[model samples]
Target: MDLSIRVIRSDEWEKARELRLAALRDPVAHLAFLDTYEAAVVRPDSFWQERTEGGSEDGPGTVRQFVAEAPDGRWLGTASVLVERAGAESFFADVPEGEQTHVVGVFVREEARGSGAIDALFEAAVEWSWSLAEPRVERVRLFVHAENARAQAVYRRLGFAPTGVRVALHGSEDAHEVEYEVLRPAA
Candidate 1:
């Protein structure tokens, strides 16, 4: 149950790839993520290297990935934040009213569920978002499949509230993903 949260390192591409593949294989991945294990597994090593570098602490500040590492060196969970500026084309929904951070690629190993690793990962991700220098994030948001009650409940417990904006899930016209957000704490 002992774990520490930290931003990934550029050299830890292999570990990042392994954890991401495992996440893609999780039961809820279909509802929680846009990429599939099959698709990700075929990506070249260079792709993973670049991805790791882009999300690493030394990488550009537009995105960051945080991992919860167990005492034994195993990654228990991860969450990433993408800075979204107003007027920029969003990958998921309409343009935002102001700078915000979108939480994505959330995952925790089954054995680590309810072990506090997920919470730790989220705290790091949200904290990093709020600490951005240039475009201070006004809020941290995430999209959860409408039917993913479990994830929705967990997010709500973590202080994210529905923002009244719903976007149809990509590739599924009928299904939707509800947007939830936690505004930055008052200064």
Candidate 2:
């Protein structure tokens, strides 16, 4: 498909913002993401600039965003990883047994689905997490809404298994997000 997967650069904030907005407008966005298009679109440019800068390749090691870009320079998909250390406060789920990376903001354009763009994006994200030095990450994890079967299947295909740990979804008292993990391979 002539696509390349790479970490985002701080200078590409505008492109990142555009792709994110497009992701938020997808039909399954409500099920796939925590933020709404209305809220995201209303955010000032500076917010996107800061967000991109923080998650860029040269930014802090705590988080990283990967994107699949076509030869034409359009982003086909994206995935982000958040580093979590045991005993530290986590913004998503509880701290894990050891240092880990939390995968989030997973999205692929409808036309790009089944084209392997999502897979490539995830591979880059996971590889980057495992490459961290000193206090290396022990695993990578993500939470999917219980009803999102499509996403669950894809994550399973990528080797993530349910950890049997469920947490209530934000803003919803009755629904839950199921945790999944891919343990680091033995050397």
Error of 2 at 70 (Å): 0.3
Find the number of clashing residue pairs for candidate 2.
0
lDDT for model 1: 0.91
Which regions of candidate 2 are displaced past 4 Å? none
CA lDDT, candidate 1, residue 57: 92
Worst 10 residues of 1 by lDDT: 89-98
Candidate 1: give the clashing pairs.
Answer: none
Q: Residues 1-187, candidate 1: write the lDDT tens digits.
A: 8999999999999999999999999988888888999999999999999999999999997889999999999998999889899888887786578789999989999999999988888889888888888798899999999988999999998999998888887668888999999998888
Task: Tell me the tens digit of each residue's lDDT in model 2 across 1-187.
Answer: 7899998999999999998999999988887888999999999999999999988989987889999999999999999999888878776666956898899999998889999998898899889889999559999999998888999999999999999988887778987888999999999
Candidate 2 is scored at a TM of: 0.97
